[model samples]
Target: MESLKNLKVGVIGLAKSGLAAANFARSSGASVFVTESKQRAECAVFLKRLAKGVTAEFGAHSDRILESDIIVRSPGVPNNLRVLVQAKRSGIPVYSEIEFASRYISPREIIAITGTNGKTTTTSLVSDIFKTAGRKTVTAGNIGSPLADCVKKITPRTSVVLEVSSYQLEDVERFRPTISAILNITPDHIEHHKTMRGYIDAKARVFENQKKTDFCVLNYDDKKVRALKSLCGAKVIFFSAQRRLASGVFYSNGSIVVKLPFAGYSIALKLKIPGRHNIENALAAAAIAAAAGIKRGAIEKAINGFRGVEHRIEFTAAINGVEYINDSKATNVDSTLVALKAFEKPVWLILGGRDKGAPYRPLGSQIKKKVKAILLIGEAAAKIRKEFSGTAELLDAGDIDGALSLASRRAVKGDIVLLSPACASFDQFDNYEHRGRYFKNAVLKMKKRFEKK
Candidate 1:
């Protein structure tokens, strides 16, 4: 294991991960050069700030990228990019941010969670469970802080709960987690992954390097995940909301029940989080916690007290007898379906953003059954509208403000104004969190306006 000292590295893309990689490279005594797509002016400005230690070029692939000893690619950059292809041809090693970060970190147990949906929630829940069980745990990776930044803080006993993306997993070599969970694989990141099989394969790599002692918690409800039970080398434990599992965790008689092979008895517990998806997430968290030898009592306590992460079914201000809910974190059709199923009240559903290539038919059907009216926003609005034309009352609001105003106006007593956009937020907002915060602020302002009236 060589330190990154004086290593000549090429960082492709000037995105957040690229910037983090650049900073990490400088801190580790490595010289870095950044490259970006020709059209991005923001990348040019970012390059100017790094004028002293880093160099940048646009449009055509720079020959200098091939000169580097190693190339650290941002998550957005594909492996098949011309520069990356050239690097491989020149025998220059290429790695993702996660791979680069993993090389520098000391060996510690990692609990990596990856899927099309519920990765964030499951990662947060698992981290909470570890904390409740009295373990030094920190949630990082794709969720918030880069794994490189948190790696130094981890002790041998510290549990690293990582929210890994398929992009991060794509280039990993020796990266292995003690507990790897693939929540549910759905069609997402299709633009990058190209095919559903590729996406599934990328997610499955979370468990690819796990040893026999390592645990792989899978979603038994998902056909794709259940099919991998025979392929994975790690000890397989399943969690499902729809079916009762013989050994692992399942929902039984309105309570979460965990039946482990060694325990000989089933532990029935209550959950604070609503929805079957959340129940599945809780079961996955509990499975991981129990595998790590955490007490059943502690696991039960954590699941019951866990209020869930913000921006996922987060209740905003109630104004004039109308309740506003922000589920901006539901960035996929499957996630929005779960959110819709959780609420029984007639919903004024605010939906749409940058499409992730998921089929909108199922969501349309769910909307037909669950939502009263649909408020459309962002680039995918028209597509969603077309899908749900006669299924539900579809209204195009064009933007978040317009959508919110319309939903607020249409919402009546006992009706829910829900912002659970079933697409990526990159079109109208910075990210899902930004979208969620804006929705909350708008709801608060509306509440204030009604109070003044």
Candidate 2:
């Protein structure tokens, strides 16, 4: 490993990834300084975990950060932040935590997954497939753990399965993965990236550094994703849930069929996860595992055993034959559409959160066809209500609690009460996970009350 001795590093944000980056840099012999926009009280828990000899500042980014040789930014920090822009102008390099961590780990294969949705599930599934094949693997990046924390501890044989985000990809430089997969892209995160094209550009960066020897996995069902194949320098492998592929992985009838130039394999579908989106996710995972040299049987076994991830269409409970689903991770219109498509039962969908610059108009037809009611919550409730006012039974439910309470009263047998907010949860809760958990706990609490009755 190259020594970071005598180097000074500045880390922005004090969230999970930021703290990990600060600690990792300090341990790597770099003089680390951590800065966060949140006050000391807000970041107390994380600050307590900061490594010894690492100095920190809270509530602002100071000139101290500008003095560092390089700046490592958390995903939460905006790329165009004044301090970061100034640092770039001053000739100091700025990188996302993933990029910084990638510099230290060489000769280890990385399977990076990115898309508007299904990143976590696909990443976890890929990691599970690798483990089932008896390979050492670490799943990190946007799926909660930072790559920085995983790098030093991982051996040369370890396979890194990363759940990358557009934010993380925005600053990547010289960070090349052995294999990269773009599950599917839709109109999301436009608020941060400023335009749909900008969001697509950032997602495309996942495979930008790959060479002919590397593998790029493309989603054949998505035109935007399929077109990206031409931009990739690596050997392209297409995976599809919509059509059969003669040269890549695809879902055919009731099985996942793999048709590589060298060999062919197929696995029958017996997934515990619901939705066509998950079938796509499984296909993507299988493609990545196959590209990594994992056997088809191991890939099939892992895919069959995988149950799904939390906060993304997770089934909470069924009280009085009414099901409650927590899909708080559906923080965009496309995701909520996927949730709606997963169910045949009449849905009492709890929609709205902090708007992410996407419109709710696209959900109108689905809501009219499949929804019993629309319970609006969070900051985007008004905007959603405006677009969907007459499409279904509209409820001005203030938040998750109100939405669940209203749904419990109105929903009947065989109906679904879904918390699939088509917007970010920042306005109401800490994050999507917190929002999902709160919805789930409230549902469970209501279920217990039903038992007493």
Candidate 3:
């Protein structure tokens, strides 16, 4: 591990990852100074970090922070931020919170999962498998708690299942996983990454530091993820949702199955999570488990009983035969599109939130087929209306409650009301989970009102 003693480190942004990075740095004896772009009034969380005796600057990052030996930033903060760029020009290295955390933790196997959709599902499924096999494991990273927060949980017998993202991967210099999986790459976070090429490059970084002995799992059905075999030195393992592979896992005849050199197993569709996408996630998890030498029985037991992560297509309520689904976790176009594919019933889709650079045009055809009508809200509403002008019946419902109200009036008994906003939730709520819970609460109120009639 590199010595942090007496080194001056600049931590940019006071978000969860940044706070973790600062605390870890200070604990390691580094002279840590924190800078946040958000104002002091907005940083109640920052004050808690400041109580630890670390110096901090809020509202704007100062030019003086460039004097540090290195800079570590939150994943939500763009690397091209003026202060970070200035640090780069000054010859000081900039690192991701994940990268900095890896240095302090003991060497252990890391199974990192990343994709446009299904990251949390795959990461949690893999973690379940490892834990069920009686192996010690910690789940963190982009899924919920930052990797830096959970690194201390790692020990010689323990493993980490991390849900990484393009944002986190972009800053990684040597953040190699013992086994890494690229679930699938679709058009996402274009506003932050700038281009599809840039986004793909960032996702591919999970495999950048892998050795020939390491394993890189991939989605064979996704051409982009399939082609990633050429980008890394790690031994590649492909998992498919389509036809059976010679070596990897595949969905066949309503069952999840895999064929590898060690042993092969067929997992009946026992996962409580409904959808073809979840099946693919199960297969991906199985591939990671097989690579890690976890027994087939243990892998099968954990995955079959795995219900799923909350907020991603979570069922909220049923009122007068109409089902409500809170998929507020669908913060990107592809994610909403995938959620739409999971159901065959006519859908009343609630779409909108803070715009985050996802192109909405590709959703036109899918929206036409699956969605009966759309209730729009938040900053992305106007842009979505323009892109999907004639795709479906589009209505401007002012907010989450407004959208739920419209769905109650417009949706038929057999129809599904799906809250699958193809944009981030920052405009109307704290995050996707908050947006999802709020939607669920609204539906519960709607259910109570309907029952009283």
Best TM-score among the predictions, by candidate number? 2
Over 48-84, each residue of candidate 3 has an lDDT whose tens digit, in order, gives 6653757888888789789899889888787678988
Prediction 2 global C-alpha lDDT = 0.90
Global lDDT for candidate 3? Answer: 0.87
TM per candidate: 0.94, 0.98, 0.96
Error of 1 at 432 (Å): 1.3
Ranking by lDDT: 2, 3, 1
lDDT of 1 by residue, 226-279 (tens): 998888999999988888777887877767777887543345656677787887
Better of 2 and 3 by TM-score: 2
Give the alpha carbon lDDT tens digit for every residue of 1-453 in model 2.
567787999999988888998999899889999988888998888877889999998888888899999899898687788999899999998999899998888646988999999999999899889999998888899996899988777878888889999999988998899999999999998889999899999999999999999999999989999999889999999998888877999998899999998548899999998998999999999889889888888998999999999888899999999999999999999999999999999999998889999888988878988999889898998888788766898999998889888988888999999999999999988889889889888989999999999
Model 2 backbone overlap count: 0
Model 3 misplacement above 4 A: 49-51
| Candidate 3, RMSD to the unseen true structure | 1.5
